[model samples]
Target: METEKQYVIRCGNGYVRFNLDGSMIGCKYKSSKTTESHMKRLPFNIDLAVASGIIKIEEAE
Candidate 1:
């Protein structure tokens, strides 16, 4: 049977990241509409995004 890769989601105030299998050799949301507006202003790092769980490792690139 096929299996899915393990991952972890680390969400912050503005963005979220996807950690593939966790411990990839590196240390390491959403409230409402108003929060969404603020989130847009903030710049979320893609590296962190993938680190959390939002984007897949391959998707990082």
Candidate 2:
């Protein structure tokens, strides 16, 4: 079985999580009022976006 790699990074005015290859998994805002806007900028869901399945987690280049 393969393993999933997850990492958190500061993106824009919030924080974001993505795979090693830079596939954005989720994001969060620094402020409560702008939380919704931050979430919308992400491509995936933090609660469900995993590195498993067909999503191959590779190294950054």
Q: Each prediction's TM-score against the native? A: 0.23, 0.27
Q: Pull out the clashing pairs in model 2.
A: none
Best by TM-score: 2
CA deviation > 4 Å runs, candidate 2:
1-7, 29-61
Per-candidate local distance difference test: 0.35, 0.40
- Those runs of model 1 whose alpha carbons end farther than 4 Å from true positions after fitting are 1-42, 59-61
Please provide, for model 2 over 1-61, each residue's C-alpha lDDT reduced to its tens digit, 9 standing for 90 to 100. Answer: 9543333344444554544343654456422122333434556653343333322222222
Poorest stretch of ten by lDDT in candidate 2 = 52-61
